[model samples]
Target: MSQLPKRIIKESQRLISDPVPGITAVPHEDNLRYFQVTIQGPKESPYQDGLFKLELYLPDDYPMVAPKVRFLTKIYHPNIDRLGRICLDVLKKNWSPALQIRTILLSIQALLSAPNPDDPLSNEVAEHWKRDEQDAIATAKEYTKLYATEQ
Candidate 1:
């Protein structure tokens, strides 16, 4: 059988040993390339105090092509779609081989702090954020309280 790639192994080890604050990524035993992730919502944001779940998968090409990641927990952000897909540059056109799992996770966390209404995946959510930001934030906070509470 082929062995796990050196980069993947190294990254997995680093993730466990030197993890980013508010983010935890652990590879599954059955599939080393697949990871179960949990991101603590950033302070002062609508998602604060909530634990957001996500899934990350490193493709065969890996560093050559960015990892596939998506939110699993319910989040009311303009950049994240109803299906949990994110509209982030690094995850899309701006990705580079030099980027890493840690960086991407950090980016996702930052996105929580700053939701861009202009570039949105969910048009409805974007409209809400644009038309009435305060109301949208209130709604997001309510959702975080209702759906993202620790289980």
Candidate 2:
């Protein structure tokens, strides 16, 4: 068995044992290294009703490197590019071995609540965010309502 599977199994157990509000994860039965995660938007954000799905892939070097995460659902935000790549600090330079899946998901939820325009992955979204916070928030709400709502 691959070491990645073992790590993911342990992480999933930890997530289940000590659940994080607004976030949950489960590995695919066919592929242990790939996980499906759901993250509820933070309470105070315009994305409050949003339920975002994420695809996580554990690299061979897990603890030493951050897992690759992508938004499976379309998300229009300053920190997430058009391609759905997230630009979170912890997922990059700030990553540490101590970080776990639960913490990362929580951080993503927090990121939605408070986006950093200065370091944005989507330039247009960032410009809107910097120029007008209210309009940006409104647009985010519109996107959440249009794309993120559950059928």
Candidate 3:
């Protein structure tokens, strides 16, 4: 692998030293561009009390192109598919070079807090959410309890 960019080095350092309140990102020893991340579910959300794991990877042309991010832990959200692909605009069309790893992860955390069924990655889940929001939230909570619990 080529030498890591100075920007990545600095971002990794800050992530470890002055981490986000409910998020933690640690790079792999062999590959600095790959990170193992964990996010605490936001309060009052269906996913509350859960801890979701995710993987984030910065490509060679990062900052110019958005970093690749996907949930590793199972979650029941309309905007997140069964394969864990998230339907967040910032990760796609709205991405900007100014966005950092921390900002991207924070956006994902916020997604968990406010799921958008209207623009969804998982159609089935979106339909479920649209049909009965309360039941969908209950299902989300059930999924969180079953999958996102600490081990």
Candidate 4:
């Protein structure tokens, strides 16, 4: 018997009806567990005006474990690695069963606005940010312009 999780259906409906600002996520029709996502960079950050793509997947035991999320867009951020893995506490050890997809996406969006270099996924980017914030920000903006534009 094919059974769709009630929670998943509710989440999808809510996401479609009341989408978050600057973020769009819709589940795949073929596979409800997978979602294609797009997030607009925060205006207050160097990555502003950039469009980032991402993929989200919910495991069978979703609320028991955090969902898997990865960026399809290349971002020049200290907490995001070259492979697009985010080094965020909530995405990892801090995740709670109570957290929903909207909240998780919101946290990811917030991370773009406030990057913490002290604990980073890309050591090189963090070093550059610590050494010269202006230069790092310029580099980030350049990367955004180059990579985040429509192809």
Best TM-score among the predictions, by candidate number: 3
lDDT by residue (45-98, candidate 3, tens digit) is: 999999999999999999899999999999999999998999999999999999
Question: Which numbered prediction scores highest in lDDT against the true structure?
Answer: 3
Judged by whole-model lDDT over C-alpha atoms, candidate 3 comes out at 0.96
CA lDDT of each candidate? Answer: 0.94, 0.87, 0.96, 0.93
lDDT of 2 by residue, 50-150 (tens): 99999987778887899889998888799999788999989999999889877888888888988999998999999999999999999999888888898
Q: Which ten residues in a row have the lowest lDDT in candidate 1?
A: 1-10
Task: Estimate TM-scores for all models.
Answer: 0.97, 0.93, 0.98, 0.96
Look at candidate 1 and give me any clashing residue pairs.
none
Candidates' RMSD to native: 0.9, 1.4, 0.6, 1.1
Tens-digit lDDT track for model 1 on 71-112? 898889999998899999999899998999999999999999
What is the alpha-carbon RMSD of candidate 3 to the true structure?
0.6
Model 2 scores worst on lDDT over the 10 consecutive residues at 1-10
- Evaluate residue 97 in candidate 3 and report its C-alpha lDDT on the 0 to 100 scale: 94
Query: Comparing candidate 3 with candidate 4, which one achieves the higher TM-score?
Result: 3
Evaluated at residue 128, the lDDT of candidate 3 is: 97
lDDT (Cα) of model 2: 0.87
